[model samples]
Target: MNDLERQSRILGVLTERPFASVRDLQIQVGVSGATIRRDIEKLHEAGRARKVYGGVAALDGLPPRAAALPFFENRDIAVAQKRDIARAAAAIVRDGSLIIVHGGSTCFQFGCEIAHRNVRVFTNSLPLAGYLGEHGTCQLTVGGGDLHREPGILYDTSGAGHTFYAAQFFVGALGISAEGLLEQHPLLVRFTAEMGRLANEIVVLVDSRKFTARPPTVTLPLSRIGRLITDSDLSDEHARMLEDEGVDYIIAPRGGEA
Candidate 1:
């Protein structure tokens, strides 16, 4: 690629991932070592990004926030596994059921799946609101709250105000720690807990990777979760925990796995 074209593309990658290594940029842009280095220098000169020991990162220095990537890019990252979990989750929706969707990429995918179904969706997620509002006939009610620009979610008093009703609520966690379903913010715990209590059922959509690590705050106890839908990579111990808590668990078959 020409120098201009290469520099522009490097800036774009830095904007998206924010923290990437030289190897990361090379892999992403499919350019040579020299090309990647030159592009990084150009970006640094433009004050768009800074180069670290092994890679380049956003000039802002913060990690790439969830909102930095639009809904579709987030969706495509774990395309097959998320779709499998989403499809399994979607099958549980009944006609005209009132569903509450928490804000996250996985849950947003579930929202996309259920949007075509005969259901009314209430969400605190900005992306889900946009997705369903555009493609579905279902009535969309977005919770009022302070917008969480990092994650594109609403998790404040305004978000919690709509908790008095809903047939089922779906949430995605940052990670599932041994402590329970975890998130990074205490406000998220309050909002998820309230919505979980209000809904008749609570479904936690987590891929297998979430089970191995934990985030900062507890979003729910296992007992509060009606079901856990994840990929087959879940360890037997974690699976046993869900079962012991009486949380119904569904493991979607991975690609080429039984």
Candidate 2:
């Protein structure tokens, strides 16, 4: 297999287990020891895995590590659930209010739901901003920053210089464990955090699949979330966790009411 594909497999393995060595990874992926070492290096560089003595292990850092895959590929994994979550989140918006949206497939879907509304949108998501401009009457202010091609986000030093504000911020979680929300890139966190600061309320759109998974990094604490919208298939245990954290949440039925 190609290097990226092999590395994705390695990450899958590492995530399932714990730590592994170079020999362990080589055996699992059926690659040469040297090839395994190269893969480990690439994973470390991407902040997706950490190099251990023998091989490498998944790096589950605080939310917002550098994601190895591009957003398009990663986003397709749980699209239907995301769309459901987006529709529910969209139902909570009040017309004429200001909102901030981060960059991700789910957030893009959320943007789509609000496109025809008369609210204002401030964002660092390049793709979402572009989509909103096409169909939304909302005043769109694209956040200034370094554009990341993989995630289609404008980030870094862009929000630090601007003192813009919002009424609510809409974001999607890459993963959510008992620890909190996680994302794959530092830039994503940078912009998301800034958006959080600008908004009075924070709404997170996440599917049930993300409940147990741990992305490479963390984005925000569960306590910071004001509301969560998900699909009806989410587990009761996961729902309890949200309740325990005092996060108001709802799971809308597929193509049904929120």
By TM-score, the best candidate is 2
What is the lDDT of every predicted structure here? 0.74, 0.77
Q: Which lDDT tens digits does candidate 2 get at residues 8-104? A: 8898887666556565566679989899889889888888887743456566664333234456544554567777888888889999998888888
**Top model number, lDDT:** 2
lDDT of 1 by residue, 1-258 (tens): 788887777778766655565665677788887888877777787787776434566766443332223343445445677777888888888998898898877898788888878788888888889878888888888888788776687766634355357888999886775567987666667778888878988999988756754456777877677888997768898888777667788987765254
Model 1 CA lDDT for position 112? 84
**Model 1 quality (TM-score):** 0.70
TM-score of each: 0.70, 0.71
Q: Which stretches of candidate 1 lie over 4 Å from their true place?
A: 1-76, 156-160, 255-258
lDDT of 1 at 242: 76
Residue 195, candidate 1: alpha-carbon lDDT: 83
